[model samples]
Target chain A: MTCKECRKRFVEARYGELNAGQRAEFEAHLQGCAACAAEYRRLQQTLRIMDQREQPRLESDFGDAFWDKLAAKLDAEDAPPAPRPPQRETPARVLRMFDWPRASRIAAAAAVLVIGVLIGRYFFSRGGEEIPLAGSRETLLQPTALEVRAGDYLEKSKVLLLGLVNWEAETPEAVALDFPRYQRASRDLLQEAGYLKTALEDSRQRRLRALVADLEVVLLQIANLEAENDLSAIEMVKTGVDRRGILLKINLEEIRRAQSLPRPGQTSGKPSI
Target chain B: MKDEKELIERAQRGEMGAFRELVERYQKTVYFLALDLCGCRQDAEDISQEVFLKAYRFLPNFRGEARLSSWLYRITVNCFMDTRRKTQLQTLSLHNDAPGENHPPELSLPDPGADPSAPARSHELQQLIRRALGRLSPRERSVFVLRHYQELPLKEIGEMLEIAEGTVKALLFRAIKRLQKELAIYQAEV
Candidate 1:
């Protein structure tokens, strides 16, 4: 055996871990190589010194105290958690099944899809011929259908409010305004206003929506008037119409709707008469 | 062997008394092994406790493929390495260990009846050796202690440490070379 090989096996050699054949080879090398033999001797001496030093003594062992301490810790681990007040299960538990970004993406995608479908139906849906949710895309997207309907409602509301605001009688019986006939007409218009209010919810015409809502409130008050001589109630309705400038707004909107771009196949938006 | 097999079965079956008996059989061996690795009485105790706790928790997974002591030995080494990682590392000093300054851990107190200077020489040698051990990194220290103190075979040491046998030999040689350098003075004296 070479000196390098013998030195490499110094630990195994000193500890007597070598087999008989290897030990014989190692011994044969040591006999011939003085440097390797001296190094081997030094290793043996160092380990001898280590062997002579006694290990430090500790007074304790894994006694009853240690076992008891460990046992208590184990018991605590095994114990069930404290009870909580019963609560309805929340979606938070379901949400925990997915990571945050993935769950949020799923939710956002669903919301966008639902909204896209609704807006698509609101604009392009002419599939079901009988149950048309909104008008055709062109009628709704262009300013034709909504503006025309709003203009008609404004004209009727303007005539009714004008007749009421005109009668400023000093005494209740002196009023010559026809309250019964106007209230009957207003009740009918009030029902139509409810439908228009719902239809106009997603409409782009904010000004028209505001005017219709205000007119509905006034019409409702007028329809509920008690008698023909209830001048106080009529004055309240008239005051509201004046305060809101309902007449001027309706007149201006009617003129704009008349002048707005004409719908397809119609040469003029203006009234023929 | 049969009795050990039965004990392992009982312990696996959640018999607390059987588990304690198993602990009782190997407690000192594990404690001293930990004591040799860490060079502190308190850390040795903590490592021993953690080893058993882990062993109990994982008892159901034990497949009876190896001796229980071998399994516990692996856990003890892993726990030592883990404690080293998680705790703020400080240099290990035998002087500061709980064994007191006069008696450095892993080095016995000088016997009163012996030749006076022999104890001093032995103590000085032990101090130098432990200081040199402290200078080695954690992996070197573990390899040295397992081979030197635990008398583990080089192959078994490799298997237990999840390293190749050749790697174990390399680490062991590196550890011994460092020790030899630290003890050059003693080698000259001898």
Candidate 2:
């Protein structure tokens, strides 16, 4: 082989990319050529020197601390806002009922009498089909159709969170491609969560309100995640899911099963009033 | 390999414990790769942390098409490049002239042949190699670090850098030639 060919082969040989035939030819050239052999030795020595550099050692244990800090950041980002105090009617307001003008008092009494008669007539007239009016106090008190719908919304949210928490990527590229379904689901849930939030404003179910509020935050985070499947976006959504403990807190299966059981005095397939 | 795949699958599912295992398994290799690329211990540590965090963030999408180690090496390279770019202005003002100024005190080389200590000679040679590496362009430096230091094959290096295999070989050849040129004075003495 010519010197140029031998030198080219030398580079290939250094990388161990040369086949046996090429290696034999390169070795044959090296044996007869003093200059090429000397150059090869120098290259080997430089590589040996480079390899002698020590791998830097960390001074202390950092893995646990680092993971802890990351987890804390994630949790902090997902933590819900402080709950507001519950609004309630006080007895002091009841005593103020007599403070109104005589005409106002007469008008209030008449309104109440009319409402009572209407309620009595409705119960008597309906016989068995009891449909509570929307936004009624009785509807809030009993298990209404709206509550069943709310339960359904919660169930959907639970499935989304489970999918996110247990997500697996077949390839790195798959991560970005696979999140549109999640984004769409989150968007749908965000709309439902908002409606539920407004509906629950006058509700006294403090625990349910609080749960919905937390679920709203998680849904919002997921809904707003970048569609391109950005790593930071994914991390943000994952952190929100983990921070709110959504997977653990919202048990859809249990909620669905509980909601399915018959209420007292209610027949199967009959809507409770 | 199966164990690694299992750990990855678990980590993808938001299992911090499984991810931590992955971190511990690759920490040393990641640290050394960063050190070789950045030529400083503190930067290497920071870069190593960034690498694993990026890995975790991107792990969900990491289709087993490439080895986990290759994915990590790709991340390490990107992290190193990012860090170098971010710190370039500061590094210029602080350590432009002094090649080994930011090198940790523990990394200081002992006098060569002063005590006939093999370790001293090794340290001296390591310092020379680091200086030579510092003289190369970022592309050349990365190609050399991945190929020579990390012992990654040429095809893998090409994949990590998103360059052709022929380009990788060309870079490696250029890197070694540059190193030989830069370390000629030390070579003569030896």
Candidate 3:
């Protein structure tokens, strides 16, 4: 056998990975040739040296220090946030005047009612014409609500995209100044985007599904940013957002003002618009 | 083995003492694995901690599909890969040192006693091996470290890596060939 063939077999043989026939041939070649024999010995010696190389030992206090530090970190993470001081109570009259939550809820309910009525009118106008319902009864029955939710997602996505696009990194510090905000927003959006994408997987609104899928990709990139101060990563995320044309695709400002907002009920601390 | 299973179960149930026990059990092995993979003590320490923390976070989802040790090994591998990637990116901007120049500053030869030259030579060989390992791609380096240093079987390595056994063998073959080439000079000297 050639020296090259023998050397190839030697590696497997050294590890006892070769079968009987291959091992026998490798052994025969090693016995026949002085050069191959010398090479085999050298290989064995090298492996022995490698195997004997000592792994560096940690300091004796390493375990204690690691446990202490990690425990502190976990403690900090697990601690509940300090309660905000109670605001001075306003007069009952003033409180009623500025009950934004109640007003917003009422407005939201009315908007949904209007959308339902408009959708009913449109379907009635269409008479017997079949509305392609994406083969789902939920979509067929609640198309208006789904459209509103889609619009809300689109608007939120635009806000994130615009934040990235409008970020002016005049100084090095400025480059990653808003990355934490971007990362949080992207993570929040990613969860929603994943759900929407799956929900729209069989939907007939091809354009909306495609846009959501692309948006998910950008959100994932943003969410996986390794460090808060990584400017290059921020730029990469911005580039991804820009490349997907997420802001331009849906005209989110117009959609937000035109469509009734669908609230998915404060998911993952994300604010509803 | 039953004791280990119980420990994992307790740790999964948010028992910090049980988790600490798990950490104490595998700390040295994980630390050494990280140290070997990273070639830097600080990074190794960080990676080791990250691995344990990640294991804790994801433990409830563990479902006991693989051995706890294997799962921890997988986490160590992933954390090392992530740490290496970040280090490489930072190195691009902050440092221009040669490969393997990031060897742990504390890596000095152990006491030589009478044969000073022997310890120095062994240290040199170790550094050479580190440099050779640094030459490997991340995937190849992980495969090589797990096979050679960790001494995991090919099938287990495949399971840990979530790749086919044939792929593991192929990667192992490639890694060995590359290491052999890198250590060829030592082969000739020997």
Instruction: State the lDDT of candidate 3 residue by residue for B51-149, as single tens digits.
Output: 887887888998887888788889998998787677662211113356765543343435233244655667778767766666666777788788878
Instruction: For candidate 2, write residues A1-273 as lDDT tens digits.
Output: 998888876667987989999999999999999999998888877776676666543546556665665566555555796686864658875656555555454554454444334433433355664332234333343445556656666666665665555443332222223356566666666776676666767765455667778988887877777555466776677788777776666675347548877977778875565
The DockQ score of candidate 2 comes to 0.18
Over 4 Å off, model 1: A60-62, A82-273, B92-121
Docking class of 3: incorrect
Q: Indicate whether candidate 1 or candidate 3 has the larger TM-score.
A: 1
Against the native complex, each candidate's DockQ, computed on alpha carbons, is: 0.17, 0.18, 0.20
Q: Which candidate has the highest TM-score of all?
A: 1
Residue range B12-85, candidate 1, lDDT tens digits:
99999889888878877888787667766678788899998998999989998877888998999999889878
lDDT of 3 at B140: 77
- Give the CAPRI class of candidate 2: incorrect
TM-score of chain A of 2: 0.41
lDDT of 1 by residue, A162-212 (tens): 656654455332335555667766776677577667668787778888888
- TM-score of chain B for predicted candidate 2: 0.84
- Misplaced by over 4 Å in model 2 are A60-273, B89-120
For all predicted structures, in order, the TM-scores are 0.55, 0.52, 0.52
